[model samples]
Target: MFSDRLGAAAQAIQAQFKHTLGQLDDVPVVRAMRHATHGGKRLRGFLVIESARLHGISSAQSIWAATAVEALHAYSLVHDDLPCMDDDDLRRGKPTVHRKWDEATAVLAGDALQTLAFELVTRSEASPEPAVRAELALRLARASGAEGMVLGQALDIAAETAEAPLSLDDITRLQHGKTGALIEWSATAGAVLAQADAAPLLRYARALGLAFQIADDVLDVTGDSATVGKAVGKDASAGKATFVSLLGLEAARRRAADLVSEACDSLEGYGAEAETLKEAARFVVTRAH
Candidate 1:
């Protein structure tokens, strides 16, 4: 059921992106934009639309938020795969944006994508209320900016050079910003749109996001590059600390399962309406790629 919804979300966002990008002039940068945003699980976007549905928000309005999150996520992946960053170049089973094009084009495409995220979210058609649009844009900026995802990336880079490997707590903090922050925002987007209490979804997202990363760490150890759609085993090769490294394989898997349970429990307030989200939590940990 979740897989079907996820696939539908991916298709919806792709159509939204294609239509939005069609307004731009035909050029290499535009091409790069299309390339970078082409494919993904679209989990973040799915969370946005699902959360909105739970809140009785219209899909038409919520889709803009969903697309915005996906765009920002794609931008992050493009920059993260740059020569100066993680370097080795594969994403979503294809060449990383920098490798597919050039580094300069990749950089510009990422920048434009980031800006376009805000443009999509703030459009009057998706969200007519100025305050709601502002809140979404503001929260997105914080989640993706220095204090959130960028901070996590910076810490990750620093860890590579640190004398000692990061502690478990350190990695948790890092992943919270890098991975968890955006998920939290995505999951809470409907609550934000509706001006409703978001505490439950926020709590659910925190657990789900951590479980997702733990699964990533586990996959890094057990997954093949072809199946995972990116270079696998880089963490061990780099000697970076990860949940798998710190807790051992079985323990890491156990921890992810526990987090998934917690994430599902956090949705109790939403009753049967949140069953799909609960399934999503389980899927995050069980997915092979």
Candidate 2:
């Protein structure tokens, strides 16, 4: 059921992408934007939709925020795969934006997507109340800007040249900013829209985000590039410290499981209505990509 819901959400997100991008001028940069945002698990958007559903928010209103987060995520991935960054050639089993186009086109596409995220979230359709739209945009800016994902990314790049490998605590802190921040925002967006308390969902996201990152670390160690839809074993090849490298594969798996349990437990207040989110937490650790 969760898988079906996730798939449905992914479709909705892709359609929204098509509708939004179709309105833009048809050019190389716009095409690059479409290419970069084409496909993924759409887990972040699913989180936004599911959380919105839990709050009795209609999909019509919530889809804007959901699509906005996905656009932001796509922008991050495009930049992350640039030659100045990860220098990856593949993403979602296709040539990355820079590899498919040029680095300048990729950069412009990423920038456009980033701005589009704000445009989507701030649109009147996303929320009737100006306050709610403002809150969503504000939180999104924080999550994706220097204090959040960007901070984590900067730290990660710095780690590559550091004399010493990052410690477990350092890695955890880094991931909290880079990955956990946006996840927290997505999970809490519904509550923000409804003016409900977000504490429980926030707790759920914190654990889920860490588990998600650990699972990614595991995938890097064990997944094939084709299966992963990107380069695998890059972390190991770079001699970067990851959960797997630090805790060993079995221990890292155990830790992710524990985090998933914690994430599920945080939804106790929502009872059976939270089952989809709980299932999502479980899926995080078990997913191949």
C-alpha lDDT values of all predictions: 0.94, 0.96
Model 2 misplaced regions, further than 4 Å: none
Candidate 1 versus truth, CA RMSD in Å, comes to 0.7
Q: TM-score of predicted model 2?
A: 0.99
* Least well predicted 10-residue stretch by lDDT in candidate 2: 173-182
Leading candidate by lDDT: 2
Tens-digit per-residue lDDT, 129-160, candidate 1: 99999999999999999989999999999999
lDDT of 2 by residue, 1-289 (tens): 9999999999999999999999999999999999998999999999999999999999889999999999999999999999899999999999999989999999999999999999999999999999999999999999999989999999999999999999999999899988999999999999999999999999999999999999999999999998999999999999999999999999999999999999999999999999999999999999998
Alpha-carbon RMSD, each predicted model: 0.7, 0.5
Model 1 lDDT at residue 274: 96
TM-score of each: 0.99, 0.99
Candidate 1 positional error at 23, Å: 1.1
Model 1: worst 10 consecutive residues (lDDT sum): 120-129
The pairs that clash in candidate 1 are: none
